[model samples]
Target: MNQLNVCLSPALIPLYNVEDHIVVIIDIFRATSSICYGIENGAEAIIPVSLVEECAAYREKGLDYLLAAERDGKVVEGFDFGNSPFSYTKEKVAGKTVVLTTTNGTHALHLSRAAKKIVIGSFLNLTSMCDWLKLQNDNILLVCAGWKNNFNLEDTLFAGAVVEQLKTGDFKPDDAAIAANDLYQLGKHDLNEYLKKTSHSERLKKLGIEKDIEFCLQVDLITAIPVLDGEMLVKLQ
Candidate 1:
């Protein structure tokens, strides 16, 4: 049986042997959820860059990349859009390559480069993500992109949701995975209400982007699974 572990924050990734595991990068407040929705809506690919400058550099590559940059819960100045899933409509992203950098999600992707395989995870594609994961032979590592390297609730709750799904399979859960599953069970009934007091939720509320929170919490709206292929995320074929 493959073992399943959850790393609650990107800062703790170094403690895990990622090279031998399939890493699921979770940033449910926005990034991964947006990736899933964009790909499902016909995005050609998404290029996750660690820095805003790196995302900008893709513009000069002549690929007509759509640049999406986010910082501190808002769209960066001079970018096409931020990390909101609503911004990734079919009319906008269809057959286009998006170069994206977010405050936490892209940073977590960079930190997880050594993993055997890296896939984006979010509530948007929860069932499909777990279905694909169960078919893989590699051990699984759920890496949460917490708020600025500090643990956050939304990502951890999503990780816990994944753990709940995978635990019924031929996978053994680590302590973190166990904790996440428990947390998910506690919050699954009413996610929006359950997260009302979380720091990230409060932060987004103050930014007046509460709708993004409601959207990200929707389960299995997308069937696409975005997997990292070299430097880009493409829908799993």
Candidate 2:
């Protein structure tokens, strides 16, 4: 049986890869969700960076692109946008590059680079994400985009949702999965109930994008799996 481990928060993420495993990245607080939405709506590509400077370097290239990032739940200085999926429209993202960074999710993406395959996960594409991950031949790791190295409810809930789907697929889970699976089961049918109390939700409310919170919490609304293809993430079109 292949081992399945869940990293409870992005803060715990650094570099831990199984010999040949798949990585499922969850960042429901909008970065990963926006990428999934962009790809589903016909985005060309998304490049996630770990640092503001690295994201800035891509911006300097002057590609037909949208500059997006956030710090402390607010748009960074001079950035065209913050990390909200609502800003990624077909008119804005179509045939254009998106260089993205966030307080948590983008860093988690880089931290999970060692895996043989890195797949983005969010409520927007949960079923397809699990289906794609099930096809991988090795172990699986679910990396949660927690709140700045701190534990957050929404990410772990999403991770649990994945574990619940993959629990019987020759994937022997670790202790973290135990908690994640339990948490997921408790909140699957009422995710919004659980998410409302999360730090991400409060931050979103503070930013005045309450609708996006509603958008992100609706499970299985999308099934387009967004996978990392080299430096840029795109749909397997």
lDDT scores in order: 0.90, 0.80
| Tens-digit per-residue lDDT, 48-67, candidate 2 | 87777787787668777778
Worst 10 residues of 2 by lDDT: 10-19
How high is each candidate's TM-score?
0.96, 0.90
- Stretches off by above 4 angstroms in model 2 are 71-78
RMSD of each: 1.3, 2.1
Residue 88 of model 1: what lDDT?
Answer: 93
| lDDT accuracy of residue 184 in candidate 2 | 90
Model 1: which ten-residue window has the lowest total lDDT?
A: 199-208
For model 2 the local lDDT of residue 230 reads: 89
The digit string of per-residue lDDT tens for model 1 on 22-118 reads 9999988788999999999999999887788888888788777899987766788888998889999999999999987876887888889999999
